[model samples]
Target: MIKTSIQSSASEIKSAREDFFYEQPGSLPGTLSIEEDAPPPVIVLIDYNETHATRKQVSTPEECIPYLDSKSVSWVDVQGLGNEDILQRLGNVFKLHPLLLEDVVNVPQRPKVEDHENQLVIIARMVIPKEHKIGFYSEQVGFVLGKNYLLTVQEEPEHDCFETVRQRIRQNKGTLRKQQADYLLYTLLDSIIDGFFPVLEDYGEVIEDLEEEVVSKPTRKTLEKIYRVRRDLLTLRRAIWPQRDAINSLIRDGSTQISESVRIYLRDCYDHAVQVLDMVETYRELAAGLMDVYLSAVSNRMNEIMKLLTVISSIFIPLTFIAGVYGMNFNTERSPWNMPELNWYWGYPLCLMAMGAIAALLVVFFWRRGWFENYSTIADDTNNKNYGSKINLLWRRSRR
Candidate 1:
């Protein structure tokens, strides 16, 4: 799971590097699509009963239609919705509504849930970390829950967190083999909910790293990443908040399709969803506070830079004017007022000493005033490995 999260974060950072901007909102649903290079769908299935179980990759959605009506549980897993033709046909074979198919094909249709008469459709966002980066790539997952079968749509063939569920069913490791479709739905939802843990853990690590960076080495990009994390967390918050309410409504409002036994499982799923939402909200608050700190740190840095420049100019200006005055070669022999200071044997050394003394005095004054120490005291290093390098980086980058 940790390896998977690392890969997800790397992928998202790379994708984000491309500078993909958003279009106008509320245009239409299922509007966004995959490029021509997208891989074809890979369909896998699991059919099981208390007595027996089977798992295989089926070639077409029609192949599963017969099993859908059977007494045993059927799970048709479609990973990749790039082939819109196959997706539309799959919708037909399963008697899916147009909007539901649209939602499934739309790639990222906002992690959501919708009711479609006899079918219960759920949209979830799952994160898989990239191989070597610091953020996670979010993928949309759509599930169509029916009376005897469950159909799920995944966006990529390269990623999924269903291995545990598959192992449980194959080994009959749990009561899953004897359960109904709704229980299967819970199992999948539980996996998706659990998947957020690693992603959230990644963010927690990020926030810790950021707290140090912001206070010690605040950069424009650091501010950018903070805002990005806040924005993505908001995306997450918006996604999970509704699903919690949706699940709560299911548990409280009562739905016939959800059995009493499955309702209990859904309640557990709801709890996990609520937990995810809570963590996201907390992270959002922390990120916002970090932004404020970043702004103040940057402002403080600017003031420090200006103060250094001011000190240099203030000490040098008067000294330069005094030197300019005596350097004039007017002969004191012709007039005593002409160059009396220059006639003094110790004049040059005295002026030099005075300038040096003034500079040293200003330094001591600033040091005593506690102005330099205040800004320098804030240490912002995250990820305990970088003890001093990051601090030095901040020092070089600091203005004053």
Candidate 2:
């Protein structure tokens, strides 16, 4: 199931990349454009009042008509968008405006709130953290609030953060049982807003882990991860930023379906949206900083490599010069002064001794100058021992 869900999510994202699901140019208003790959609609009805509550899966939209007229609060959750006929029937049953139905069917619309006389339509985006992954599954959720009923349409059947709300309704926990449909809307919106915190926590953890990896030893893959993180944060920001305005509109605008008390609760939900936006923006800045850190790390590594190569080359230059001079083909017989040392009994040994002495002196000079401390630091770090005493003592002696 996990694999299938992941695959479907990947497909959804691919479609989003191609283009958002939109109506064709010159198309009539309220024209519905359903994706060919959308899953069939599944409607669930939950009717509850202070005294009694009932939950059941309704096969057809008409089954929900009777409950909408009751004094109790009815929540009709319609998941998936595969069947247009069913969605149309559902809209007709609820007496939804044609344009309102269009917005509900359209997947991936910007988050916004529109007051349609007695009905309050809220377009929202919900995100669920991907299982065993660093990203989240995002989908659009549309809410149509009436006098005694709230209709919610979602893009898919799975990967929603509304399960907690469902559990609350089922257990009759909190004041959800007593509240009207507007209050129920507030509760669900609050749940959706609160859901962002956990996903943001995951991102925070990822940023922490990347900080360590980027500083220690960054790689091409690290760069890719950083870019991915930035992209995802941007996606999150896009999702939550508009939501703030939408929630604000809900609070600021007048609506008969939304009561004064529910509007007050929505103020809290608006605050949560602001918090999510803050976290997203902060994460985006951190991700951008990570990119800079990755570049600096790569450059530092390159410089270290070059420094090591330069040190090796500097040591070999003198040796190469001595060897080249000795390798000359000058004849000792022709001139004693030219090659007198070539005939000495210990000439070969003396020459090797001289070369070794010169090399040792160069090494001491470079060491006292503290040029190789970085290498020592690496060694000491790995062994977890103070291996720099000798170098420090030598440095002090040379300074004296």
Best by lDDT: 2
Clashing pairs in 2: none
Q: What is the TM-score of each candidate against the true structure?
A: 0.78, 0.87
- Residues 1-400, candidate 2: write the lDDT tens digits: 3553455457447644743356678999988888899999889999998877888999999999889889999999999999999999988998889988998898778888988777889999888888887788888899999999999999899878888888888888989988999998988898888778778877877887787778777988987687677767767877888889999988887688888998899988887787778677777787777777777777778777888888888888998998899888589898876867777899889988988898898889888998776541222143422222322233234324
lDDT per residue for candidate 1 within 1-400, as digits (tens), equals 3553455467457654432224347766544465576678999988999999998999878899889899999999998867877887898998987767877777555555676578888777776656576666667778888889999988888887888999999899878988899898889878877676566666776887788888878987996788678767765665577667767776786665679989888887887787777677777787777877787888888888887788778767777887787777899889888878777899889988887887788778767887455554465335644532333233223313
Please report how far candidate 1 places residue 185 from its true position, in Å. 0.4
lDDT of 2 at 150: 94
Total colliding residue pairs, candidate 2 = 0
Off by over 4 Å in 2: 1-21, 375-400
lDDT of each: 0.75, 0.81
Candidate 1, lDDT over the whole model: 0.75
